[model samples]
Target: MGAKERYILLLIIDSLIVTFSVFIGYYILAPFFLQYTMPVLITTSIILLISHHVFAYVFNLYHRAWEYASVRELMSIAQAVTASIITTYILNILLFQTTFTRLMIITWMMHLILIGGSRLSWRVARHHLIGKQSSDQEKLRTLIVGAGKGGSILIKQMLDTPAMNMLPVVAVDDDSTKQRMELAGGVRVEGKREDIEKLIKKYDIRKVVIAIPSLSKTELNEIYELSNHESVEVMIMPNIDDVMSGKVEVNALKKVEVEDLLGREPVKLDTAGIEEQVRDRTILVTGAGGSIGSEIVRQITKFQPREIVLLGHGENSIYTILEEMTGRNNNIEYIPIIADVQDRQRMFEVFETYKPNIVYHAAAHKHVPLMEYNPKEAVKNNIIGTKNTAEAACEYKTEKFVLISTDKAVNPPNVMGASKRVAEMVVQGLNQNCKETTLVAVRFGNVLGSRGSVIPKFRKQIEAGGPITVTDERMTRYFMTIPEASRLVIQAGAIAEGGEVFVLDMGEPVKIVNLARNMIKLSGYKEDEIGIKFSGVRPGEKLFEELLSEDEIHPNQVYTKIYRGKTVSYPIIEIEKTIKQLENNNNIKELLLDFVNRKEYTKN
Candidate 1:
């Protein structure tokens, strides 16, 4: 039916309900209300029908879609019923000049029940009692991981819309008291979370839905690990607040991504402090199109910077990030500067024009084996690039300058690590000399899912159907999500002091072989189905990586997940001399070692 037809049909139904309710109320109170004549009964019925219809229009009840009815819709029904009854009571007292007060109470209850139920019944008939079919083999048998609010809502939505192609057969929760309780559509809370694998096996489940939005990352990791199976697909609900606010539907659950497995407790940032540091200020992000740099720009945009300068070497990368930011129409000015950080003159020119209040230098040579083979490129990019940016920031009298360093820089094993160490020293040296700018280095570990990261490589191999390569079974490295690392870097800038190397608390080191195995399982393949190969560690690659050197003591934690390490002071002359030697034809590895150690310093 058309909207007008539906509205008129509902109006007619509501009119009948109002009249029948008043007649029933009069019949129930007939003995007590001895003064009830035919005229009085007729007048009360007329009053109820007219008043109810008028109030229904006021509440916009007939205009609403009953198929999507929820709590708000039910509340509107209640308001209309109450208003109509009150209006009828007043009309009866004035028009009929008869006190049917007791009868009015009876009529009110009956009218509310009949009218409200009449409207809500359509929703029930549409969602719960209509078009439901028997469990079919073609439909996916789904398991819900939580038996809480989110889970209940998800089950209801699924049952309401069978076109989603998933049938919720069971639910599990950690709350022992809730065991054996039935959620909507009779999906029982079968057992505790530990019984997931058993439940999946018993039910022949094909899909797992994590419906607890408040679950900690640690708990999520454990659940994902338990649910990893060749036949099962995993999905998760969005944040609980979003679901409750109608910003997201319970049925709109997303597939679990690689970053979710490494998620930790959500970081709580110092928004006020960050705002004070970034708001209304000119910000410069070097390598802004890169993984960490791009995330930094996105987060910084939330603080409403006056202007953002996207500085990178490649034009395509710079153009892509600029378009994304502008397409959002964030209303913040973005200056895209395609300049290589290795060029000192270009860095100076950009800084001179922008005069950025804060500079986040994320440009560096990160891939270890590649940097080891081309040591000169590593030095020129990681080391000299940093020096150029730092010198330019200091020269321009920037308020705060942050260099993105890595865990590899802790105890050097490769040219990449040594170059980062030397870059850290350059920042320290500049902090000593330049009194105006607050120079600091933020050190983190491997960023999960970044370009050229192992996660992507393993995912591709899994998709290709064989031989997922791992450097070694024993090799492990600390991992943090790109957003987590970028946020920490911004936090470090906010809390920076001159000459401090801030280290983020990378929760724990994850073994590469285990990560690979999890990826295989997540891909719905058994280990035998897709073989894992142990390629021996490559050149300059260590069996493990370190976050901080043994001699560097982390005496204070500046923020949650952020620690301040005691600064290591090296002579500026020694650093400059090492750079000079690196410029000429010399043993790149020896010069890098001497630069990092300062023990066997030789003047060029």
Candidate 2:
């Protein structure tokens, strides 16, 4: 009903109940108090009616959603009724010089019951009639995996929101005490986690939602595996806090992704230390539009930097990141420079103008096979571009300079890896002489959901209804989320002294073929439905990528998931000479690889 109609209807009902309550109370006590006549009763009715509505409006009793009424709503009605009764008692003593004590007590009881019943009946009627009709519709039989507070809330929401078309049939909890216990909407916890497969068969369940927000990755993976039936789809509930706070709806369950099954806990950052180093500092990030660069920008903003210089070759990307940063925070100044890092003059001018306290040089050509095909382009961007930016940082006396290196740079076989290694050497070489700027490198493996990453490629192939290609069955690479990688980069800066290559502990290496299979399953397809194709490994691709070389391993973690490698000392002159050769050398790829791998370039 419309708000006006609901208000008027409730008002009429309350007025009638208020008038009848006083009259009935007077008549019931009339035998004892024979002196009180119809005139006195009529006077009491008028007083009760006005006082009830005034208190009702004060308590906002008329504006509540009675269809969703609970104890809280009933309590509001009680308070309003009691206040009105007290007002009527006081007015009776003043005007009639006599008060009906028994009548007032009886009237209060009747008024409370009638008002509360009128509101609570809406909830009872809606729950039975509307909920039953919704359940009768064609809905997926859902199985909830947790029977705690999160599970209870989810079940109630599912029952209340029939338009979602997910009928929660049963729930499962590992806790023995909760087994066979009924939760909201009469959905009982049928069995333990081990009984998931059996329950699916027993209930013919089509959907399973893991409702435990604090479930560990290992436990979540186990639950997902058990619920991985051909016709069944597994999903996860959003965080319980988010749901309760109205940030997201309970019905907004997300599909399980391979990233969730990685079984690695996120690394906790030293927030206090990071903030001390980053807060109010003028920070500069090259390649600020790319995946890792953009995430670093986002993470840095948390510390409330005074100003951020976003330098990138792509105008569109720079504009995009600039727009996003400005929308979120207006206090910090964001300067976007659409200039390539390879432009020495432009890089120098930017540094001189901003004189940033810290620099994150993320600009680079990172694709492996693509870099191999056009080694010159990789040399220009990755090698020379890094040199130009690092040199500018040194000249500008920047406090700290962080190089976003890659795992491929260790024991490298690809042009991209070799180029990044050369870029690292440039910073290491410069850090030797540049006392003002602390230059360090943070190395990590492939980040999930980055541009041109395997996950997005597999998703597109699955959407196209065909085979998802795996480069090789044996290919394995370390994986971390973009935010994790970026956060570690910032953390590395907090601990950086100089010339140290900080390797991130990218937990375990995952096989490429297995990752592809997981993606297909997560997309609600069987193995046969989306066939796997084993294309031979591409050029510059390795069977496995290493985070640190044997000689470079520090054997101790400097921080959580962050290790500082043994600094490799490279002669600044030779490093510059090799970069100069990239201008006209025909065998640029061969020369770049030779320079990075040669032991002679390192000092005794």
Candidate 3:
């Protein structure tokens, strides 16, 4: 309605309510009190009508849209009702001396009911009238896998938001107490999880929205495996803390991506340990623009570092990391230095200038096939970059130099892996000679959505409306989310002493075919229709990638989940000669073969 029309409607309604209340008060009390008459009561009624209108303005009564009225609206109603009651009491006490108890009680009840109900009535009406109509036509029949606070709030929000177009038909929860119980919005909690298939068919549910955001990876994977059943697309609500903290917006309610389905149980780390390492310290993240480097950059900032240097080779990467760091944390000092790590002079300059107490060397060429094709570049970047960074750390008297190595470095068949093996050797070899700096390496598997990862390639293909290609059906690789991998790297750094080849226990390897299949399904395509083309495995692509070799394993007493691998050690003379040959000559192929065949650059 227009402003004029709304104001006129409000005035008319307030006038009628005020008049009716006074009239009723006078009628019942006239016989019992100082001979009250219609004219006196009529005068009082007119005054109250004006007074109540003023009260309504004070409460922002006309300002509020009743569709959103709740406890807050009711609170305002109480305040306004109190104001009207005081005004009425004064009028009857001073002029008529007719304070009829029963009459006043009736007025009080009527005033609250009539005034408060008016504001809330429209909202109740909207749900019943508008909601019923919309649900019949526009609702997406959905099932809730978790019948908890997160689920209930999501359901309420859906019901309140008419545009959501989602109607939760059933709630599936494992909590026995919630079973067969009706929630606030009359949503009934069904029995335990075994009833998923039954509930899906019973409700004819088209979609499933999981409300357990804080669930451990194990719990999430279990749920995903169950929901992998046909025809029921799944989604996840933001976790409890996410909703409360406002990190996950209401619109962030979304379908389950591959990560959510493949995730493992949550790992509760010693935050105290992490904070102890990061707080009040200057941290240098090498390759800060890359996936893992950026994540460590993110995670470390949360602990409020003294300063963080975003050291990377690529100019664009430096800018991107600087941009991200600036957006997330402005309080901490972040310097983006773009310099190739292969240059000893450049690395030395960075170390002498920044003087960072802790250095995280994440700079490396990680792509397997790409590195295989460009072995020379890989050696120069990965092996040489790592050596320069480590030596500079030692020279600068840095406390810890953590190298971000990969599982590929262990018994590696590819050039990328072989170079990383040499890189690990450089770090550990430095640790042996240098006592001031503790050089360590954290080895883990592929990170999903990293640069040149299969996930991004599949997404791009899907967006272009074409056949999504997979290297091989039987090919399998362990995976972790980008941020998760980075966090683990930081955690590994915090936990490292010296020459500790810490390997994160990546839960299980996922088959490449299955990953492709899930991505296809998520894009709303059937297998046969939007065909998945099995492109033959590229050069250096293995059928199955192993985290470690059979012989290079040992139990660590400190952290059971992390194991230390046995690495072949080279004589200082041999190491120096190999590095000199690599730097002097561009023939990385000869060095890689000799290093791999002799296992001279093997795991530690």
Residue lDDT tens for model 3, 191-221: 6777877777788887778888777766776
TM-score for candidate 2: 0.95
Pitting candidate 1 against candidate 2, the one with the higher lDDT is 2
Q: Which ranking of candidates, highest TM-score first?
A: 2, 3, 1
- Give candidate 2's error at residue 291 in angstroms: 1.1
Identify the candidate with maximal TM-score: 2
Model 2, 172-229: lDDT tens per residue?
Answer: 9999999889988789999999999999999999999999978888899999999988
The C-alpha lDDT values of all candidates are: 0.87, 0.90, 0.79
Q: Give model 1's clash tally.
A: 0
Query: Candidate 3 at residue 536, lDDT?
Result: 96
Structure candidate 3, residue pairs in collision: 217-264, 217-265, 217-266, 218-264, 218-265, 567-603, 567-604
lDDT of 1 by residue, 256-338 (tens): 87678886776999999999889999999999999999999999999999999999998999999999999888779999999
Per-residue error for 533 in candidate 1, Å, reads 3.5
Q: Which stretches of candidate 2 lie over 4 Å from their true place?
A: 33-35
